[model samples]
Target: MSRAQIAPPAPSGPARSVPPPPSRPLPPPPVVGPSTRLVDLAAPEQPLSPHDPRSVGEYTLTGRLGSGGMGTVYLGHRAGTHGVVAIKVLAPHLLDDVDARTRFLREGQTLQKVTGDYTARVHGVGFDGSMPYIVMERLDGPSLHAFVAASGAVTDGEMLTRTAIALARALAALHADGITHRDLKPGNVLLTSAGPKVVDFGIARVVGQTHHTPAGNMVGTPGYMAPEQVTGNGALPATDVWAWACCVVFAARGDHLFDGDNILDIARRILDGPGAEAFGAVHRLSPRLVPVLRRATAQDASDRPRDGAALLRLLDRSGATSAVGHAGWDRLVGGGVR
Candidate 1:
């Protein structure tokens, strides 16, 4: 498959309604190359190496933002404009891996289709020669994981509720269109001035589908993968719901109930299925929210909230919604709420 990127058309209507699932047997996305320009960036913690390309298409590389398991993201600027964007280039190791390339391309395509207030926006996706990349809006904020690491775990109840609610709504948006963010975790949840914007859909697919991956290869982080994910049975929006509970708990305790141990052991424990009873230790904060999480992380996917829409209703009944204004949100990013 020729490496490609797709820029979803600008949103023309409300983003909450359901849409048809993306056509399968993937097609190449249109090549979208923005213009070039220079943007001064303070040196990143990890600067671009001599080997890194100075630009991809018309966007000039400014600095290295960061990298993930599958790609290196660079800060770039479009020509003749003051716009800054995040360029996510495919990791060199996976350049020849067809599955990895497919997943990367699918991620860009998924972002184009799944859009809402909490969904991360994609500018375009394309290949700079053989290198596939996705250009996305530059969200200037720390990830939920980074913020919790810098500060301690979230101790405030309202703030925790706000975080939980924001993530639930984001997931609901994806589930509305039958998309599942198979890799829902703290690192993928960017805490921006606009609240939480869900990013990285590298492993996302339609609910109840798993054939996208090579058999026996699990598609999610060990700690957050649902039971079916471990067995490679199938994926459901509930699979994301299970991971959602894990992220919320990470914010509250800065740890996972089934945390630590090796990946194999963690997967085994998750398969063993620990429910709400295991979360008794952290009940002090968000006592009501804990029960909701208990159900969200249920061992059986059927026992979970079903989808984001249903999950939102569960949160509402639990009073998880809160008036966590700017001040409360600021605390998560160290007074950096924009």
Candidate 2:
């Protein structure tokens, strides 16, 4: 199929893709119930950091796992079930901003609605003072980004196939809930012993929510954004498919598909230039896969796969497998970042 034609931008260049109409406003935040806060009987005695003390209902904070623009994630344990959970504590400074808090809370609610082993599970949520925190299943694994960084480009066709399957399943679960994981980069995909688990839904939007992301405001990771996303058009399931294709390309070649001034520029190049040549150097990949990747990364969202399941089927048709027997999983959990 021919790629979607780009509309001209004002007087020159391709035309900009128009965003879908805003949906209804998201529902009010769910009320915190008594069960939401378990006893701190097994809570850790020491804080993960001096800045953010570890105390949220019954979960004890062990150490700081990671921090991002939104908040810090802590390794915590729940005494009730002896379960390890990752607690996401929003920055205190953001409490006053209703939009930020609503987005943060929406992440928790969105994950809770996604029921699948490929997706992270939300256990509970509470507050440490005005800072909101969410308790989630603590996954022992490195993000796909970290794995690629350590192992270099994944040349083994089998490993790439496994990763693709896990990710596709995760995306399928997300779409089933009427949710779109606007962000689908390597960093957001965690590789655990059980399997790959897709995490980080801070920028996700439910189908019917009206709080449309503003134009020119990008929400996903730069290198993985779809062409339409770069144009400031809102993302859909197809957008996730485009990013998924980028992930596959990264696995095969260990490089970005576009080299533009920024995400928007990259999107423009992918839409208008010979962007499919980015994967030319990867010899391990099947020649047939090249066309599939090109279509997945098509400038128009409509040109991509219908959903994650469809993507998974395409990857399966490639016939790839894992070279090492779960060694990647063990190394990821055991390796410490200094």
Leading candidate by lDDT: 1
User: lDDT of each structure?
Assistant: 0.70, 0.63
Q: Each prediction's TM-score against the native?
A: 0.80, 0.76
Best by TM-score: 1
Itemize residue pairs with steric clashes in candidate 1. 5-125, 5-126, 35-79, 36-79, 37-79
Structural RMSD, model 2: 12.8
Q: For model 1, how does the per-residue alpha-carbon lDDT over 55-141 read when each residue is reduced to its tens digit?
A: 998899976666545677888898898988888888888999998888888878888887587876899999988889999887755
- Model 2 per-residue lDDT tens digits across residues 41-146: 1122223555556566777777666654567777778677666777888767788988888888888888788877777778876776677888887665556665
Model 2 earns a TM-score of 0.76
Q: Estimate candidate 1's alpha-carbon lDDT, on a 0 to 1 scale.
A: 0.70
